[model samples]
Target: MTDPTQDFRRHLGQHEYELLEDDWLALLEADVSPALLFETAELAARYAPGEIPKTLLRVLADWLGEKGAHRWRLEALRRLLALGEDGPDLPAR
Candidate 1:
């Protein structure tokens, strides 16, 4: 079976996987749909969290809150928790 995250992974630009941290984070702020936001968050988690910007991390957290309920929001909330920022409350899984 194919990886469930592959589709999300594909949403990332080549720059993101290249580990050009600045460009990667910038994509998060670009014109992307909520689905892309979920993918970007997942991509960042795959890398060293310490390398990600706190501002962008918080931005993702806030987007998840403002974007309302999508299935990925719950996963995003869990990942954002590792960034030590408060995100919207999600029901216990």
Candidate 2:
């Protein structure tokens, strides 16, 4: 099946995809854009392509929460919830 994540970002072409891949790789290394990461995770979950992305989303959500990025963490949790994950337990502001 065609990857929905790829389809979602297809309009940006391959260069953008490459850049997103780079961002994905650098997720834990630096202060990556939480919005972009959340988008990627959301797309990955909506597609339900495989386990890897789902696992990554879970990890990313926790990481964002720990990093005190509550908004992005809630977004990630929402995406995960759409995939039938446990409901979001958002932290206070």
Candidate 3:
């Protein structure tokens, strides 16, 4: 049998990634490193493109800003926003 979480992680397309933002946030709330969160976000973004939600972006932005590393969040946000604006080639959310 497959590990459900691993399977979920492996097939995390944009819409699914967006849905999983809550899980990511919970991880963050549990005190996971900002760097790790950022990496996970990047992976989700690459998989799902424009599917990330604004709420998740704001959370990430706040975290990065709090660390005085706004550049990282800004860059990632820019990419996500651009993707959102242009629309992704994935299935409907």
Summing lDDT over every window of 10 consecutive residues in candidate 2, give the lowest-scoring window. Answer: 11-20
Sort all candidates by lDDT, best to worst. 2, 3, 1
By lDDT, the best candidate is 2
- Give the Cα error of residue 30 in candidate 3, in Å: 1.8
Candidate 1 overall lDDT versus native: 0.52
Residue 63 of model 3 has an lDDT of 72
Query: Pick by TM-score: which candidate is best?
Result: 2
lDDT of each: 0.52, 0.60, 0.57
Quantify how close model 1 is to the true structure by its C-alpha RMSD in Å: 7.6
Instruction: For candidate 3, report its TM-score.
Output: 0.50
lDDT by residue for model 1 (1-93), tens: 333244335533343444434444455545466666555565666653454534445566555566675454566656656666463453455
Q: Can you rank all candidates by TM-score, best first?
A: 2, 3, 1
Candidate 3 structure quality by residue, lDDT tens digits, 1-93: 443334436557424554476566565566666666666666665665454544455677667667787677675567556556333422232
Candidate 3, run of 10 with poorest lDDT: 84-93
The TM-score that candidate 1 achieves is: 0.42
Tell me each candidate's RMSD, in Å, in order: 7.6, 7.5, 8.4
Residue pairs with backbone atoms closer than 3 Å in model 1 (clashes): none
